[model samples]
Target: MSIDRRRFLCRGAALSAGLLLAPGWRAWAQSAPMLDPAARQARAVRYVEQASAAQDDPAYRAGRRCANCDFFSAGQRCSLFPEHRVSPDGWCMSWTSE
Candidate 1:
């Protein structure tokens, strides 16, 4: 007699293939080890702004682009730097403003 498909595929239920075969239950499991909640990489931005007011300052230079910054995303928008224009002259803790 043929068996019902639904009954044949019950999760965690053991099914025997034939004589001499050990019954093995079918189940899904995650491949990766679970991570501890306390241990994780977290990115946070404090702030970003332009020093244009001191344009003549000795420290102010044009080569300080955000693209070269560690925090600046390739798209040019900074997470903490709200400057919409996101000028290359901008500076922030999240400044990748290369």
Candidate 2:
């Protein structure tokens, strides 16, 4: 059996659209491994799992946290740390308001 080019292209486009529109697909794609505070990247950003724990640092502000940062997304993902997720309550020197 042989398939026509037009039919094949249409099917491929449909499949691609279906996957993009599927529920939870975005969440699954965004989810990444949790960030380790002791990792080199985390250290460079001074990331702390608990915002309050960063109180000793001059950059620490009273209510700043990952959950409220511009770089944070669903599933604790942080754009600054692409490979890992940061705690919602985490604080980092790179944090920016949403």
Q: Once model 2 is optimally superposed onto the true structure by TM-score, how far is the C-alpha of residue 52 displaced, in angstroms?
A: 0.7
- Cα lDDT tens digits, model 1, 1-98, are 98788777753255334322432211111222322212222113222345343345454455554556665543344444323334344543433432
Per-residue alpha-carbon lDDT of candidate 2 for residues 6-97, written as tens digits (9 for 90 to 100): 99999999999998777675666456678999999899999999999999999989999999999998777889987888899999999898
> Model 2 segments beyond 4 Å from truth?
1-31
lDDT of each: 0.39, 0.89
Deviation from native of the Cα of residue 19 in model 1, angstroms? 47
TM-score of each: 0.28, 0.72
